[model samples]
Target: MKAKPCENILGLAMGSEQSRLRQQLVAASMGMVTTHVLGVCVQLKICDLLRDEPLAISELARVTGTQPEPLRELLIILASLDVVTIEEEAVALKPSGRLLLADQTGNVVQWVQYAAEFCAPAWMELADVLLGIPPAAGSKRRIYDALSSKRYPAEIFHGAMQDTQVEISATLAEAIRLNPGEVVADLGAGQSSFLIELLMRYPNTSAIAFDRFSDFTAMKQLAHAQGVAGRLQTIRGSFLDPLPFRVDVIVFKNVLADWSMEHLKRILTMARQGLNPDGRMYIATTFVHDPPSPDEAVVSLNLRVLTEGGDRSEVDYVAIAKEAGFELTRQERVAAIMILEFSLKGTA
Candidate 1:
């Protein structure tokens, strides 16, 4: 058999299909590596070791009180992912991993655990989620609703919310430009991640953080623990109702993805009405590729959307804003969340 030679760019691309396939395999393999490293880091507390000095595996075992042999293997594997390194006589977190997989008093270690606890089991049902009506994970029904009970989801949901909020709040601080002089309203602000972080960053600003009445007690304690107690005001109400106060900025952090586009727009419309003319609106949440298309998160989010039915793209959201008389200023990615900014036309 004779091999065909490339004549033009398209011809070259056609010959490179194998490379594309290899690229996909590499991408998928990276995800598997990430999942594996997460599990071991939690057990070995590799981040804890890196917290002090670059400890050797033996010392890590001593500090954490685990066997060195297993920890050595774990560190070696972690080294491959650059989550940790086994250098000369010490193990340490790589710079990139340090930002995420670490606990320096502020840790989202639970999200890694969430990945393992909720997602790993769901992946097992991927075959079903992809083909069947819908898997338990993708339904808009909360874990409690799908499981036909409320106890389990409530117990773990807040922890997951807090864990997810920690990482999200960090990135949002950078992505969202705010004025310390301006008052801010946090809608659906579970645990008030924004209020806690802002109190430390902006001395002049005060926040009116709102969430479900059910979440008030715990969120109150969290606000105090973050040391923003004086500046933090918890407003108890559902987002569907009128905000009791007016503010310069309103943030819907990680709230939109749970809804259908129509419902989402309705909520944004309601939010727009509550804002001062010069007020700014900020929404942050993550989304998967067109959800009807095949995706890992489809099972979980699909059900969630069905319940509220509002996860949408920038275009869809912008269209909604236009309909509601607000202008879409910009959309950008921050970590896994999409940050959307809006303003009332003719206002700041």
Candidate 2:
């Protein structure tokens, strides 16, 4: 499993136009190699090793428990991907590589690891699965089953969810209105990172972070570290189960895009049933276009391989919400993710 790099045109001017074009094509075709190289570097904490100073290939290989020859080749590939800089047989971190550091607030290394090790493997079987030659062998199924079994990939999945929460927390906190003292529930909350962030930002707010998994050790520690443990409660149960308490806001962020239409409606109905008189429901997802662009194509394929369904337009979302006894009040786009707000039908 490896990431497929997007086409980069900046390096195309190094040779004649025809030759450059050919080079670009070759680079694009081998993008998976670039992704794996970067993933390996992060998994090995190579950037952390080189954070203070450049390291010779031999030293890096010794520290990472690898042979120098192959490690050097991987570092060279990373250099091409602008992840690291190679100088006279030594390597140092690049700015882009800094984002992969595990200590950084916006670190993407976990997401990259999940993409390369989990999602990419599923994607490799996309053509056969689409053609119905074999069953869906996506990591989604593996990860889903791993949760109950408490397996290793489940932790990787948690790390990936944290990465996504780190990327979208600020936008999500601002996009939806959260009044002080309001009770907010995040359905299918992974790691409860977003709820913890909101609790920090809105002191008077109390939140319920609900998910299916039995483990909440890391989430409780996170809330305690953020000094909001008293206000945030973790609930372990399936989203399909009936909710017992009513809340001011119910969020299904990044949750619906993976669900089948029937399950989506069921979840929406649960939200509706759990809402207070004037409560609001927020559904966030990345929608696909009718004529899917390259970016949308990747997203759609990712969803298809990982979940029961893929992305749908806002119109489709609205129609589905209506069936669940909710009315779409507004929709806003924050970067690439869409945040749609819904209210109980016939309510102000």
Q: Give the Cα lDDT of each candidate.
A: 0.65, 0.78
lDDT of 2 by residue, 170-285 (tens): 67877877898899998888774778888888899999988886366778888899899999888878777689678999998676777789988898888888999899998877
How good is model 2 by TM-score? 0.82
Which stretches in model 2 have alpha-carbon errors above 4 Å?
1-24, 132-142, 150-152, 165-168, 178-181, 200-202, 214-222, 287-292, 333-337
Q: Per-residue alpha-carbon lDDT of model 1 for 1-348, expressed as tens digits?
A: 322111121333434778656655555554645575676677556686686568777778887888988768667666766666677858877765564544344555656665655555545554553454453554433343543444334423555577657666776666766676778888877664667777678878888878653355666677778777888787767676666778888887766666657777677877888888888887776655655455535544544433434356667777877787788787888656677888997764
TM-score per candidate, chains pooled? 0.57, 0.82
Give the winner by lDDT.
2
C-alpha RMSD of each candidate structure in angstroms: 9.2, 4.5
lDDT of 1: 0.65
**lDDT of candidate 1 at residue 143, scale 0 to 100:** 42
Worst 10 residues of 1 by lDDT: 2-11
